[model samples]
Target: MTYYLGIDGGGTKTYALLTDDCGNVLGKGVGGNGNHQIDHALAAQSIRKAAEGALNEAGLRIHEISHTFFGLAGADREADYRILHPLVQDIGFTRNYSIDCDTMIGLRAGTNRPYGVALICGTGTNAAGRNPAGQHVQVGGFNYMYGDFGGGGSLNIEVFRSVIRSWDGREQTTLLTPLLLNFLGYDSVRDMFDDFQDHGKHVPVHAAKLLFEAAAEDDAVALEILNRQGVELGKSASAVIHKLGMEEDRFDVVLAGSLLTRGDRGWIRNMVEQTVAAVAPNAAIVTLATEPVVGALWSAMDADGHAVSQDVYDKMRVFRNFEHIKHQQDKRL
Candidate 1:
């Protein structure tokens, strides 16, 4: 049986998986940050370590693998490929290799039919969809300053502004102020201002969990934020569904990312479900049920075709224990 490898490279962590033709996982590996935004050396080091570690665990040498599929954040540009190519080529494992943005993998992962829409709302946001007709559409995903609504950065921005407005008395103070202070390690709001100046760091966008918590507690301001985020994401999804002309049966929405996939709040999911149902009653929203490594493998094998075998599909599903990872505070996790 042929050996295949898939790599999911993220901003904070990298994942590697090795499998045989039957889809049984042979080995798993973990590595540091592989995001393109980081320095090329650092990113390559992470990928190399992950690939080597996984191969070692699987009791195989690099050249023994037949194919490798890498889905990563930095492959959005030609320049990015230039930066990543040498590292991958140097590995000398799979002569058959493919690279794509993370969303491409997600789009392919959650579907048995091989075509559907995938939208992510983690540290960032982006949407992509491919129809049976082979045409495609994408929305947002530009960058944080430009768009990325419903993403971690967007949530952080909202919380920061809410605290500012509350302090200025322009908006009513809610439970969010104390929550923010506690998360930021500030004794008080005034102390937070000083700390912000000192670090000048981007607030933990993932801390939007606090807003979700507040909404669960029925804080009006937090609820409004989540509602607005839902509307924006709904609009993004609508654009993809319409472009694909999938108004007949319920088209799949592969919801990936921290904000949309969590079971705790249910506020964002509820808001999106309500708005999307109003616009397109046939839409079916579900989490991306497979790990992206499976998608990467599919991309490598089927890039030249439109269909995948049930054997391959079934094998991929074996690794998709999709509920193992939950959203929690970084320090807590």
Candidate 2:
């Protein structure tokens, strides 16, 4: 029984799935932060731990696996490749593995087609485009230094800045002022700003939801922040589409990440949909409908030259999440 391994390594957690030739999951495992950009040692340990746990559960040795594909965050540049190449190779698969940006996994997971654009609107913004000829191009996700913006994290800080701007008389008072103060239980903007100053500059990523709440109440400031963010995300996607010469191509602009999947339909998400439609007239926007790691599995199968069938995807859908997958081990067991 040939086995395949798929791993999605991200900053928050690492998840790995082991499957048989038919895409029937054998076992799944998870571990800690796996973004090598944060800590190479931690990422390496996380990947190994997750992969080993899955292998142990499936009672299979690394040698028994036919192929492995790792979709990893923080794999944006050549330096990242240098770090990840040796890191994954240390897993001892005899080189039967493939490495690509984690966004590619989102791309594959959200769309049935092999080629299209993947837009990530999470803690940070990033995008990747795949053309029919198998060419790949990535833009943004390099942080502010690289002109990246329009993710949940970006929204979080921008909200605070908006509050500061209102206080400085640069902008009119916004619902965000009261909404944020109430949400965090701060007595006033001055107190909140002082606390942020003394504690740390970083705002909690969850605070980004406040923007949507304020926008829902018809707050102009909140709406502006959201519009700018949506435009930024759309701009990133548009850049990728044009670079790949897929502007006129009919394809799915797969949307993944916390913000787009759950945020306001009339704002950020709608803006992305509109942007894709204007640039790529035939491009349709769709939220990721499967566990992202399933894309990792599909990528592995594709990289190994195996045909990916509807049945294969159907079998993998059983992988909803790490917890869900663990609860439903193979019935044959």
Candidate 3:
């Protein structure tokens, strides 16, 4: 039986899925950082290792694979392809290969139909939509500096601003400032200032965790930040919806990203629900808790023009359920 391979290459982790021609996933593997900015050679090595590991776990050799699909960060540009293609080709699978950005795969993953929208909020943010006619439109994927609002980095930056304002006695004290200091591993606000000067790293992506923590404690600043975040994300989603002329179309708005998948997705979900309900009342809201590698695999099948049969969807759903169970058990343990 011919097997297909699918990979989801992200900033923090690379996931690989091995599946048969019929799209039943056999086994999976994971690897180190695959963000294009973080050492392409090492990232590619990690990807290749993960792919090989998945093949081994599946009890299949690379020679038996018919197609491979890689959905990755920074794969949108020719330069990125220049850096990544050689490394992927080095794997020597060679029957057929396709590559695209993570959002493209995400849009394809949710349904067999051609029209839908996807909003990704992770270490960064992006939005994309595909109409039934195969026409597409995207908004706000410029890069971290110009865009990427409603993401970890954005949340962290807001926390930092709140902390600084509290230090200056300019704003009402909240639970966030204390938590921010703890997160920075500093004894005082002055220490945070000094650390930022020394490290020169402007924003702290990890500090976004404090937003959820503060929200849990009912901090006003945290709530406001999260609300604004929701509004911003809503605006982005609205832009994509308008671009598709899908205001009246019944389609699914698939929330695909680390931010949306996690338990902390509450605030964003609230925003999405409120905004979309008012504007695109007919649109369905769904969260893709499945790892994007599964989405990438579904995308590969779609790209190959393979009919997504009930058997394939059922098998994938089973794997997703198994994964969810394992995740819950791990959390309990």
Candidate 4:
């Protein structure tokens, strides 16, 4: 009875899944922030805690795992790899393990095909694509100063700026100002600004949801922000497609991340889809309906020379759905 481990480490949370060679999920665990850029010790702790929890739930020891795949955020450059590789190696407890950026697992999660693109827009944004010749193209993983845009962080920043502008009378009056004040429990934008400057207080990521709520009410400012983000996401996806030379090829473009998956707010997903379709007409846009840890599991099985059939993929999907339902039910208790 061989077990495989798969981990998806993100800015907000770390998720670990333990499964058998045949794709039967045994256990899953989640932990805190895993973004290495934020804090190395915190990231390592999150990864280890999540993995250990999953292993324990599976009634197995870490050393019993045959292989592991870690799909981690902030693993783009050599420096990132330098910091994360050893951490993974130290905590993995397995000799056979691989570390890759989150986008790789996202690509695999969309389709079994060897060539496709993945665009992740969550707390941050990144794009990666692979061509049939095994060549890869990546774009826009760097933070805001490096020309990256379209994510929860970016959206939050934009909303904050808009509120400030409205307060200063530099921009048209926006509901964001009052909504932000209410959300942050501040009496005025000046109070919010003072707290931010004095205490390092900042807009929370959940504030992005407020933008959607405002958009639902047809607030012009919120709609504009959502539309802008949608365009940016689409353009990023297009850039990856062109760089990978997949424009003419029919390939899967996996859209993963909370921003895109969040309940069709302001038709942001529709805007993204329309823009991408204009550029890559043959590309299929896919929203990741299951956890990306399943993709990491699939990658581990593939690397270990196991045949991952469609039936296996279907079973994983079903298991994920069941787990989601059970989790929801547990919350009620």
Candidate 5:
């Protein structure tokens, strides 16, 4: 009756899943943002809340869990680990746990093989890959100032800058100008620019949806932005493949994150697929066939020396798809 915990702590939300040694899910809970880079207090709060909720739903106490795996955002450096490791430990609920970047879980979500690549592009972008020889390499995840781009935040900033340029007559007129103005409740682009500059007003993350909507309408500017982002994501994956010496080796490249998983827009995914195929013709692109948290569960089982069967993996996949459908339906309501 050993229970394990798996957590996927991301920029926008955190998810926790409780499972038995046989991979049967006992309970699932979700909570607020857990990106340590944004706010440490909030991240810790989210991690605790989600984990507690899952434990309660499973009718179990935290001390009963045998092992826990946390895949968290902003855990790229040793400093980050220093901040997160103790925070998770302070929960005082689990006997053993491990923490790593969220990308690791995304990688595990795609393949059971020991070697492959993962690219995440949601609130931020990052790339990680492992070679068959156990060597690992990573790219991006340095934040915007460090030349990182091609995530929701980057896309929003670019669209905002484009609106400012359009207002200043520095760039061609774009549908984004009016769309953003309306979305922001501004009567004029000048007022919006003034508010942004003088008042520090920021565009919402959901503004990314507008960009994709415009692109779907064949807006040249919006399409170009998405195209560039897709290429950038592809190049990041390509860099990881080259570093891992998997250029000719067939491997799985898992694609996850809000922007890449957007149901209506296949252009971004297509661009990435085309770009990667040009370099690594044999690489298989996996579109998050299961939730990343499931990977955490698999890792947890592996750590505890439990046998994981293909039947269990299939069951996890089915459970994830059901959860996804339920989430979408709830959103509509």
Candidate 6:
């Protein structure tokens, strides 16, 4: 009769799942942006809203939940914990709850093995790893400024960089300039730049999809961009694998985030696989097919010395369209 709560607090939307001791998900809820870096107070409200919805649907109260686990964006560093701990406490968990960066849950979500590497390349890039010894490590930046690569944000920035470079004659002409112009319905680059400047708008993250289109047309520039992205992703994963001394270990390389999950093993994913193979030949690549909150819940179960089965994972399929949620929900208005 004991119930557990698991939350995935992300930049786009927050998801909460409620389940019993047996790992059968009873209820799930969706809420707003839960990245505390955007606005901690508001983000806390989002988490609370999601948790409440899940609890309500299950006809259970917070008091009845035995444990709560939060895998949250912006829970990256000690400073983040200082800010997030108070917020999580404010959301009604006075004690007996656990918190970690969302990447940890993504790692657990992708594989049944307890130890492996995780490479995330969706809106942003992050790398993490765990070993059989229970040791864990996270490498690279939480944002592009930290030299992170291979995510939609960095890819979007690169596309514009190529456009500006080609326009100024610093680089050869690229399809990105014309493709972006047509995509945005602009006649010229000047108009596109002007419109963005006037509105203080940057390229949207989803625009990264253009790389695939350009590559499909055999655009050299786009192909190069994607290839480099894949290599960088592999290098990041390699670093974590070495740090965890897992290079010789046979483990799963969990690929999550929109960039790798979508498409048919595009340039980036292929290059990543090649690079990881050079470093960790024993590693097998796999995509995360479930919502990451499943990992948050499974991690809690693991902590309590319970073995998670494939049947549990099969119940954790993403219930909603993730890309659609990222694009349409939790606008920062």
lDDT of each: 0.73, 0.83, 0.76, 0.81, 0.83, 0.81
lDDT preference between candidates 4 and 5, better one: 5
Name the TM-score of candidate 3: 0.87
**lDDT-better candidate, 1 vs 4:** 4
Ranking according to lDDT, highest score first: 2, 5, 4, 6, 3, 1
**Candidate 6: where are CA atoms >4 Å away?**
182-185, 317-333
Count of backbone clashes for each model?
0, 0, 0, 0, 0, 0
What 10-residue stretch in candidate 4 is worst by lDDT?
Answer: 317-326
Q: Lowest lDDT 10-mer window, candidate 6?
A: 317-326
How far out, in Å, is residue 162 in model 5? 1.6
Better of 1 and 5 by lDDT: 5
lDDT of 3: 0.76
**Candidate 2 residue-wise lDDT, 19-127, digit = tens:** 9879888878887778898789999998998899889999998888888999988889999998899998886755788888888998998888879999887767789
lDDT of 3 at 181: 80
Give the distance in Å from residue 7's predicted Cα in candidate 5 to where it truly belongs.
Answer: 0.4
* Count of backbone collisions within predicted model 1: 0
Kindly list the per-residue Cα lDDT of model 5 for residues 216-247, writing each as its tens digit: 78888888888888888888999988888888
User: Worst 10-residue stretch by lDDT in candidate 2?
Assistant: 323-332
Worst 10 residues of 1 by lDDT: 322-331
Per-residue CA lDDT of model 4 for 1-333, tens digit only, reads: 878888888887788889997778787777767889877899999899889878988999877888888888898888888888788877855487888888888888878788898888888888888989999878888788987885877788888988988889888888788888898899989999898899987778778777887788888888888887778778888888878777789888888877776544536777778888988899888888777778888888777777788888888864454345336645877
State the lDDT at 240 in candidate 5: 88
Which clashing pairs does model 5 show? none
Candidate 3 clash total? 0
